[model samples]
Target: MTAAEGHGAMTAAVGSGATTVVEGRIAGTASSARVTVRGGRIHRIERLTGDAAAVIVPGLVDAQINGYEGHDVNDEHVDGGTIRRMAAALWARGVTTFLPTVITAEEERIVGSLRAVRDARALHPVLGHAVHGAHVEGPHLSAGDGARGAHDPARMRPADVAEFHRWRQAAGGIVRIVTVAPEVAGAVEYIRQVSLECLVALGHSSANAAEALAGADAGARLSTHLGNGVARTLPRHPNLVWEQLADPRLSAGFIADGHHLDAAAFGAMVRAKGVDRSLLVSDAVALASAGRPPGDYRTPVGGEVTLHEGRRLTLRGSELLAGAVKTLDECLSWAVAAAGIPLADAVRMASENPAALLGLTTRGRLQSGAAADLTVYDDEPSIGRTPANVTIVAGTCVHRGPSDAGLAELGEIPEELR
Candidate 1:
């Protein structure tokens, strides 16, 4: 669907006058609840029966997404239309809100992409509501092998406040998260400065325990994809992995796509961070939803990449992963299956924790006065076994799966989903 069509569909759904009430067993609670939504905000939540078969949870929130459905977020050609398509695709996957993450690139490319996203938010209603903000992931990361991942080493550089100001201006101050290498020159001060405006996350680094702690002291509060962007092997003592895992002040984001981390490692990290401090991120790329066959394919960056079995993308002929390719729902399923986390806790990691991390109070909860963003599914914990039956954004049914006959009877598919 076109951008205008997507916006029009979302407007029609949310602008309707009637109230919407959904009944299901609420996540993180024992009883089933009747959630009342009116004028796009939750009007009331009344506990009724405790025997509902379906599960209801707050809509998933993805803090980091590079691209999806064959549209690259960092591509210079990216525009408002691309943003709309991405938003619609995410909505179908049960994401009510997300950040279009822009990774390390040249100054002009980064600024242009940021401006495009800002403009998309202003021009498209669905995208405007779904895109909470922009996530800037690099240009200030480590250049060493494994640490750099697929980011271009030639464009990598130390932190610069002036450059950051330009990016903020380009994005109209919508940048909510910035990831940096703690070991970069002037990075600690950069974190201190930017933390005043947005969250500062450490990633793509080879920092030791001391350096990581220094970054934390200077206001870095998060580790971006903790175990992935580091060397394959490290010294046994005082390494970046152990350091970040042990730091109480830093919450870590993990890509629970099953391939990014081993099951044992994923379980250990979750245990270390505990349920309250850990968050889930989908660092997915365009190829994630492109429907392309598994094999080698060239990309704008990362050169030639290979899509392996289970949709894992990696640098051609190399052991390094290009980026994640799973939706947050799939990641949640992996968390439940691989790490043995409770389904409720996995949902929280995909929703509440990231919302709290971003200071978004209204979007992540299913309480009175909060936005009516929610997902309905069957009792199965595996995401694929029980895909979102219905996804509501701001009290409007935007996506109704084949099994959601009730929702489909209410209305046709939104143009955004088409």
Candidate 2:
């Protein structure tokens, strides 16, 4: 097949220098363009043409994603096939890189998931190549039944550094973020130790302002799904959630699916934390891609993950989300249309801020010398109209929809995989 048939987009040497000039808007900016790839890296960007059919933005980076396309990373049987499918599904959603988040579960299950991720890397090197790393969301978190969400009560233990170390080793050093509750015993030290190698985030906690601040001081730099994974109600002032948001040193992620936070509270965060420090997480589940039917949805926890129905349906679950029903791109759309955030700012929340939290300099931006991880949206200055028309990773086109895949699924599998 021809290169155009394979990628839906044509790649030809442009200009006198054998350069590939991708002319399109950067984010929502109506007329800016980016030119990339020289010596196997992004060379430069310039505004060369009028607004193209799509806006070119960095491919999204979601720091917290539990599952996708019917695969839960925390499930008892998180096999390599599941991880591969999850990665493929995520890429189809315009995610060039993400942290395959594993939430609270049994120790053995956690190890199994980590090893599955490791084995996926071994079997499909493209997955590892796209994966920013793993985000181990907690068994060493809050013990409060309400606060810990769907975390298995039996496995809820004190912050165990050795266990985290073991998980890191088992995953072939893919642990990039660990979210814990500062209120847990020895949580501060665990945060300190883990932050030395990977990012530590505070979440699923009953901690007050002081405890939250202590975690921040101990090197906790992120708050996972800031308001979703906490108690039902918090103290009027200086609450842990409020404290984490008010602190300038900590960057917080939020589930912008509109179910996690109300319009007012979500807007308040945007105003309080500013776009630079506020990240957007899909917090989606395995059911996100194919979509879930009206029935009981099972979670790692005992009961099923349910969604209420009405003019609006709220996700019903303890702490872990109902299921992956939203993509990071969709979350960005909600942040813009629902919360009234700027299109560019919402894009940054979905990409740059999350990348910063993960300490991933290579995967977030469209700057010269960075990886050409880009997404082209079909619609315009309004984010709601922008659909992911094309996705490029490392200057290579991985997805092109009907214009490329022709109804069949497309994959980025490398020849030497496994």
Candidate 3:
């Protein structure tokens, strides 16, 4: 069962014209307050007497996601059910908005996945609100080794505007972002045209500095998982990473799960791009979650993959990493713990930066005018204390802890999980 269904019924009735009050400490602070929600927007926030009850912040947004927990969006048989479950699972974490990424696949298969996401949104209110759109990540990428990453080399093809139109139509015009290889034939022209329809991003490229800049000039505005999609070795003077970092036009997405990028590199790159131009994306797959045993697993997209020690996932027999196995919530904690980034900056990368890049002004912020989408933790996230987090969407309480227990689990009594 999806987390929504597994949690029984929602605590707040939808469209009931009711006001909901949430008591919490503003996340990253020690102050306590009560937030009032009405008509799906935060009505007011007033200080409350007593210690801070919970840790609250704007709902997290993920730009690139493949799957999470046991639900695989790119599985061969993915459908509306898969999208629904994926949304439910992510909501159980702190992610309130995300782009369900459909990676390198055949034309028909890709269309099918897009249609499924579109249909799921139409059929379910919670799922629809949580999903922003589809992030089409491939079929137009570098075919060379190392750069290709987990995508099949044979499936990599030149960018084609016509194919993108077809995918967009299949997704009911909800295709928000598309990733392209800057060096591929017709890439510049393809980016110019497709970007008019949706945001075009650069990734999986075996291109030099000039071509990368050319792609940006062609209206490519984001770099997909900047550090991980290119060759491991590069010339010291000029490379795609340096060019993308130096250019201010492109906002970059990062898989900050500690496996796709090391702490030092992640810190340096974030510093270069600044928190406003940098976003944290899971780039996660089916096996993604907090903890899973080390073993061999089969997936339709990656074929044979292995979950190694320390939550690292890789191709069964290769040194190249496969995909991220952590959620945006976990990645936020990781950034603060390992990268030396401030907690507020890391949260902005996970929420505000991505929402602004996508033009979603109503989300990714905590204020009276913002939408009532929030994530609440029982306590601050640190090495010793991991507290339970609860998700609130449009004044509705969706997911609590594992057993889905009492309101006291929100930290008045004790810290549970964060």
Candidate 4:
């Protein structure tokens, strides 16, 4: 029986307009809800009286997820099976839809990972796989060692539209987001080229205000991991981060995992960019499982990075910091309480904001005719603790709490199972 049915039906009648009533704490308000979902879209929302005073929020849309659940997308050995498995794992983590981010790797490896994601998407067109698109972090980026971060300096270079076109084809037309350094030669034109077809992001570069704005003018809509993938000691004024955050035309994405940026920095960026233009991405690596154990994490371009502590990891760049440990949910929490962002606004950053930034049509909002993606969480209004328990992708439960079992698995082909 479903969780609600398992508790025995205690019907609380509402307007006949209701189809499926979801009871939970609404935003930061007192626990209440009678959210109706029909035809895989939220039909209506109303306050309801119920005992399980939980909260219902929109499911998260992560534009960047390099790896999770013991599977790294950058790893050369990643296959269709691994991609499907990873997609399933993310769904359980409250991600309704996500871009399978393949970070800097050899050209061949990037091509392979893109193909794997494409195959997985094709195999499961429904939200089961939840592969809305693919995010290519890049080999075509800055050459400066510091700017390149964990990306192999050798692989990093100026933009080449021909190479990107080849990679896009190999991705089975599933490539939607591509990160490029506007400072690189030919990158401006290349941004226009790729942005014509996909969402281009400015990342791993040392572009100043003029160059960064040029990228935005060239149709670069998002900045990948805003504060994490750039030079360490940027000039105090008019750097890429400041420019991107200040430009109203451009949208910014954050790792939100406090490790990516301190509370102060994170709050400043949010202030500059505004919640409407800011998005939460879990630039999570392959070892994002519980128990912050140190492990070797392989990247698409670089060989591996050793997770050393909660915030530190050894990567290709001698002094570059690696990916973080926190989930997108945790990131949202920090943004809300610690960063002093409103709960509704923080939810937008984790959901609607990313969807708008990435140009996703029917996601991010819990409104009628939108994709039925939802994140159910336990909320402590007093302490402002909101932890996600279940993630529903396309109206089907993907991840559940320890209390929930027998939840449906996504992208699992019965024929392939023994």
Clashing pairs in 4: 25-54, 74-300, 92-399, 104-301, 105-300, 105-301
**Higher-scoring candidate on lDDT, 1 or 4:** 1
**Which parts of model 1 have CA positions greater than 4 angstroms off?**
1-16, 28-30, 381-387, 412-418
Ranked candidates, highest TM-score first: 1, 3, 2, 4
Q: Per-residue CA lDDT of candidate 3, range 1-418, in tens? A: 0011112121221222356666566666655666667877888777655566456778999999989878877888888888877877787778889998988988988898898889778865656777888998998999877888899887778889999988877678989999999899999999999989899999998999999999999999999999988987888969999999999999999888888889999999999998889999988888986668899998755789988988888888987778878888888888889999888888889988999999988888878878888876766662113424567766666666543344532332111111
Off by over 4 Å in 4: 1-21, 49-52, 127-129, 295-304, 316-319, 380-388, 405-418
Q: Count the backbone clashes (under 3 Å) in each candidate.
A: 0, 7, 4, 6
The CA lDDT of each predicted structure is 0.81, 0.72, 0.80, 0.71
Tens digit of per-residue lDDT, candidate 1, span 313-392: 99999989998778888888888887898888988899888988999788878889998888777655535344577788
lDDT of 1: 0.81
The estimated TM-scores of all candidates read 0.92, 0.87, 0.91, 0.87
Residue 91 error for model 2, in Å? 1.3
Evaluate residue 182 in candidate 2 and report its C-alpha lDDT on the 0 to 100 scale: 93
Q: Which candidate is the best by lDDT?
A: 1
Superior candidate under TM-score, 2 versus 3: 3
lDDT per residue (tens digit) for residues 1-418 in model 2? 0011111222221322323455455675654554655643578765543335546778789888888767777778778777777776676667888888887777778888888777776764456667667888888888775577766667789999999988877678888889999989989999888899998999988888899999999999888888877778788997998898899999888888777887789989878988889988887776665435655666653346665441122235433444346778888888888889888898888887787767677767878888777766555443433335566666655555433323122233344321
Mark the 10 consecutive residues where model 1 has the least summed lDDT: 1-10
Best of the two (2, 4) by TM-score: 2
